[model samples]
Target: MFMRKSKFRHVFGQGLKRDQCYDNIRITKSSWDSRYCDVNPKYVAVITEAAGGGSFLVLPLSKVGRVERDCPLVAGHKAAVLDIAWCPHNDDVIASASEDCTIKIWQIPEGGLTKPLTEPVVDLVAHQRRVSCVKWHPTAHNVLLSAGSDNKIYIWNVGTGEVFTEIDLPDLPLSASFNFNGSKFACTCKDKKLRVYNSRSGECLQEGPGHAGAKPAQVAYLKDGLIFSTGFSRMSERQYALWDEKDLSKAKEMNELDNSNGVIFPLYDADVNMVYLCGKGDSQIRYFEVTDEEPYVHYLNTYQSKESGRGVGFMPKRGLNVNNCEIARIYKLHNSGLCEVIPFTVPRKSELFQDDLYPDTPSDTPALSAEEWFGGKDADPIMVSLKGGFVPTRKDALKVVRRSNVLDKMPTRTSQAQSTNSEAAAAPSLPPKPSTTSTPPDEHVGFDPQGILDDMRKLKLIVKAHERRIKTLEEKLSQYEVNTSEEDEGKA
Candidate 1:
């Protein structure tokens, strides 16, 4: 286990791996998914969806050194696979959730997925709706959580084909996850609420409203039982909030200034207490270090994705005190269906910079009381916008290019006869310093058909949102109609 000592960790280089899959006979739009399966702290597994519809691919963090292409894993899913997770107890096994409304479990070979999956050992079908998210229990090998359109969270025991419990939430559940200790889990639903539940008892222990008037897309647990959620705000701003699980009345802190234009992807790095936040606003990944004390957010840095539209995952860091904070890497589903594994060497020490670079003074922590924290006329939240959209941390960006060999892969410019090209004519000038409403990495490249499939993903999100709203509104409407009918009968 790598020892984690302090905050001033150095940035490391990322490894590159790619596979241009063209085996499927039926050609349709290309789609991509990404996940980091840590079979061990030293070996992180990365899985990707091949272009069009075929089989899923897997790559190990160790094999990155040999420059071998990613190979397909167990390929039983007849449709595009959506989510993949590694079992906690047995590292060799993995579970996949697909659009086919089924969750398939497979045992990975020691040599890796270089060979075909003759068959999936287990196929569970408990979800009545599309299984959008699938996660393994932190401690239990066969325990899993799958949430989807059914407005419910299902706790399934992979050892048997039975669901241990079902959480029939009032709204559509968006994202769910188990904490490191496995004592509790947190989930976000379409009602803009963050609910923490006991995994064993299957009971809601605590619940809090998040992203007022807007459905929350993702929620994550931080150190000291603090939870973070990202979703839309009533004003359309991408809202990110930090809440204390024990006290759900109000968020310890709330940041609603993300201008990702509705792109709602989020991932948390529990090791360094960092949040790897990415989505519609920029083509890069932004890092925010979570502190243990008040005002728990420290803007760390950002890294641009090599391929246009890719999903991202932070490799699980067991206990490494390396210079670079990141232990493993995964891409966000982006324009290019290409996925790469980034292998980095941690540095000794490093400093952080940000737009609202708060001085490392005592006043950094909020002096406000709990009453002030909630249930009052709150102070205006601080809005910090990095001048050029997602500002890339130079070291991190260079590391990505160096390890990924991105520059070498770019089309070479063969300038043969142009001799008198003016200095002004050359290097056309950077696009008008993008305004505050800067296009997110995903949106910037969203136009590239190869980068993002049909924007069908956006449609799915919107449809889900509408479905939740209708569900809520109809329930209220039915109650009101009943009350009015009762009054009419009394008058008669």
Candidate 2:
């Protein structure tokens, strides 16, 4: 009987439901450091610190079964690799720039050491100082750009593995970027200037002011040929500025940002014309959208993790098929002293990209069909019904009523005139006699004297209240004037 009772309980009892994938598998800081993952047609190559302290490792973004099949694609830099670039046109090609003052280009499947790219195809050692930035050409597939502490920018061609053109800058270059079409490129340097160049001719097309203090950490291009720059001020303020491509002599400063913890990781999302300022003492990512006026920025949300660090790479537009896709992979240097990746999906989708008919939450769940939303065999409409019905009925209704009252209560000539007369004498204005401007009625207009009288009474009360306020203000002003005169005479 005890066994039978247990069996019945097991068969009929209900408990907690299984956790959804979105909630259960949060991208936590792992042992691996994936600072930047660039996706190609066939593979995703991530740039990470191999054992910390200047060493770098590259891994392909593929899995054999459940575990990732990672092979060190490149090695041999004496110092920490500052940055890496992939050949925009070739899937198996990549390049790395390091603090060792060298830039190496490698083919993925090249032979030599046991691991692929345990060797490099060609090495370019031209920079006198540490290389900080590397980027591929917008249109020229094999061409790349590298900037370093030497305050120089080198344009290189991978085919020849040589410097194609060398350009000099005013200060130590921090970040650089290419425009959408490849016609122009821009760079931010320690000198506090953003310079735009003509990629084909290597000519300085334009340059703009970015406050000079600590050089800009990042620069990016926005739509309509606009640009953004982020850096720190001498006063310990974090600064962000926007510029127009045509005339770079001046820029519109977004706002004087208070540095949260003296560290700012600024990133620009061109797909949505948004620039994100991340990091500091707080673990929140702040977002700013570009506009003709001043750029508007707001804190998106905060991540609660001491393991989380400042290194985050936003997935470019080509990566995912959704709007305001903010699941930017973030990392921090921790634990065994390795980088960890945290994937964050924005809680709400931008209103700009939402459907005109109805906006919804950002859900990883596969969207249900119309039949499912209405009534389907597998779906329980009650769940959706309850979720959708969560809208605050009472508060929303009051808001609508308040807005309607604003337009409904605007002072009209008839109401204003009725308000001037005493309540007993003032009568509601008679409906205007049929005028030529009036639409001809099927029959003569019928007047409602009682309705008119009630409206006139209400109008008189409102106007009288306004008149009382005006009279009070005038009396105060007269008293102020009398006091001023007396004070002046006493002084004389």
lDDT of every predicted structure (CA atoms): 0.53, 0.50
Model 2 lDDT tens row, 23-113: 1111223221123434433344445445433433443333211222343335667766766666544445567777778786665542212
Model 2 misses residue 340 by how many Å?
Answer: 4.6
Query: What TM-score number comes out for model 1?
Result: 0.60
**Candidate 1 local lDDT, 33-120, one digit each (tens):** 2232233432344344445443555555445423234444557776667677765334455777776677777766655676778455
Among all windows of ten consecutive residues in candidate 2, which has the lowest summed lDDT? 6-15
Residue pairs of candidate 2 with colliding backbone atoms: 54-80, 309-332
Tell me the lDDT of candidate 1.
0.53
Q: Locate the minimum summed-lDDT window of 10 residues in model 1.
A: 402-411
lDDT for 74 (candidate 2): 54
